[model samples]
Target: MRMSEKRAKMVMSQFKFLFFVLNTTGLYVSHESRDASLGFMVQRIRQMKFVGSVALLAFGHRLTASGFTTSPHLSPCSQIQRQFGHSITNPTRFEASVTQRSLSTKPLEFPENPSPFSTIKNGILTLHHRLRNEEVLQWRALAFSFFSSLFLFRHAIDVKLASLWTFLTTSSSLIPRIFRTDSYEWVLAVSAFFFYIHFFWYADVSVRKASEQGKVHPWRKYRLQDRFEADKHRRSVELKLRRNGEIPSQNELVKNYSEVTKQTGWNWKAWTCEVWVYVVPLLTWDILSPRRHRRLAAFGAPTTIQVLRDITCGLLLYDILFFTGHILMHKIPLIYRTIHAKHHQEPEVRAGDVVRLSMVEEVLEVGFSIIALNLLGAHPISRSIYNLIITFLLTELHCGFDFPWTPQNVVPFGLATGSRRHHFHHRNGKHYYQKFFFHVDRLFGFFQKDDGSLHGDSVKPNPHIPPAWQ
Candidate 1:
């Protein structure tokens, strides 16, 4: 039963009990005959009261029209006898003034128009109600608050991430000339490996320490008092001046952490068996294979043609490996947590921290570049550019700024370009993975835009099912 109906029934039941008490106390006479006993009158009152109570509670509007009247006479015996023509010559009436007074004094009073404050307050009470009733207001607030933060952060991170491009664009140019000699090929290969290893370690450390707590872990509280004091002042000022927005809840942060752990774990495992055991050895074989057949049929060899070719192949292979690995990572829910999800731990990854990923993430990063170079037969320079671009793009998208890429740059390129797009993925991680090339994702129809905006949009809340990681 609906709550209102149940409440009405309970009220009616209580009214019937009160009627029985009143009937017994007020109507009892000295008579003890079967025709007119106190018990009989009490029972009659109960029957009439039940009818009156149900009429009032169940169909109160109809009862009000009927004057809440069950009969004309005070007792049913007198009313029934009169109706049957067995007359009580001068019957006692249920005093009209007393009855009217009792009827007029109802317990409940319903207003035609509710108080304005309560109308406003109740309208904002439920998530469903807020979304449905005050949609524009909610949306405007969301966009105004969050989109501003998302864009600025995205731009800053992208600019900082541009530094990695220097390595790719500069070093790849040297590989073309050096690959001609066997000694140079080995040197470049070994050098590239070591460089990647150093970067991997550095990134791992940085990522692991990305948290605010992690930053202050090594020092004593007293030693870090100066930093804390400075942060406190800055925070106080920000809180005073900052615009209000929906603060990310603890649940949201935990969700991001869980996503990152999944990504990192899978990436680590894949790199271990996939890279060292399989990929590296395969590339080495390709390099060694060319040595046995030095005499090409007719083509003239460039200075570092062999070395460049090998490096290019390695780079292309890296891309394929990582891209495929990413696809595989999402295929099985169990593997997703330890491998591909860890990169999403930070809701707003800084540009300086782009390379700061788990060891597994590093491996995926290298593998992605390798595939682009190896399989596509791209030059070492091109491969390097691709790697640099990937790094910057990843950081920029993850930075969580709405205007991160700017107007011209905002052409959606999967999850790697738009901050608004990727931020949604980070916020809700069950979907929105393995989407970097915007056209590709668009072709596949994989986009999921945020519903709420700070200015003029409404957010329809999805079923509040947390992501698989959470």
Candidate 2:
């Protein structure tokens, strides 16, 4: 009797276990997603249920068989037991049919038109998916590096170097310049010619920044217009500004500077964007500006013909180096991905974007320029002139202003690579590797020809319209 009761209790526990297993199976089936398909989940749940049912059947069958064998005649307890066991054991015989029926049921389908909220949810999901991509992760890493660099510059330079720089400036700035070289003649000549380039650089950068912020003043602004006429439109605007020539008074000048300071601070950006761009080339020039140490660089002045000849020769040499190096940087995936990509990141060129290069590329280009000038054995006067022209050309190309009388357009169709073409090259880096001239670019089939057929004065980008350069 104790054996029978124990067997009966054991069967009851098996039924309870089966109940828990079936409930858990249903719970698992409830959850579904793109990853967890309905068909797959349902199949898994069915398999669990089938196994649980089989275990329950085996236990109940053994319990019922023992009760029936112990009784000689039919008893109420035995009859009830037998019936209960039949219900429990019957599932094993028919479970295959039940499983087949469940499996045959169609998987759920998503609604044809998702709700607005669902559409937004999908969009967000898609964006999240894309954000997880390798390229996006790389961008995130790059962004992190940039922000961390900014933090260091903001704290380290502003707190540490600024104090030292301030003290040095306070003491005697001229002393440092004088001490850099032995002769005062070198100082005077370098300052006399370099002043023009430095002044232009500072002014152009300040003006460009001011124009972007919509700061109106007396001077002609390089503003982006939504609608404009032909190339003549830019020329007409400039001509009108020149004809009027409304000079700002002292009060206006102070206010203009104040506005500029508000938009742009003399912080890390001013150093990185404005000062460092020209400073690198200047440092390079000091070493290679006048290689022969001739009297012309010290006391005497270079004649017009000498300046022109030096300019022509220096340009040819530098152009070859720049063009070849640029093409190589593009052609080599490793170099482009590592270094040149930094500069191309700013496609919409600004005055400061002219020298927006990696330290490696910046140093390389500077080397190219200074070496070319040294190889030509240029005088300081001619060297300065070459530097001035190159600096002006680069700055103007990046100024994002197109005028009919711009130096590139002023030079003629097939000669110089104009601001328009250079801007387009920035937009798409595949073509126009030559900076100043078209001779090499044309020969290399990388030139974008200005046939006078295409004309548009609108500098502002239209989001809906694709770039023609691309």
The top-ranked prediction according to TM-score is 2
Q: 90-207, model 1: which lDDT tens digit per residue?
A: 2122222223445333222112344579788777686566656653445645555665664556655445434433433334566433434334433444344445444434543443
> Residues 247-304, candidate 2, lDDT per residue (tens digit)?
4343332222122312212123534463556465655666666433343334343444
Question: What TM-score does each of the candidates earn?
Answer: 0.31, 0.41
Against the true structure, whose lDDT is highest?
A: 2
Error of 1 at 365 (Å): 3.3
| lDDT values for all models | 0.41, 0.54
Those runs of model 2 whose alpha carbons end farther than 4 Å from true positions after fitting are 1-301, 449-470
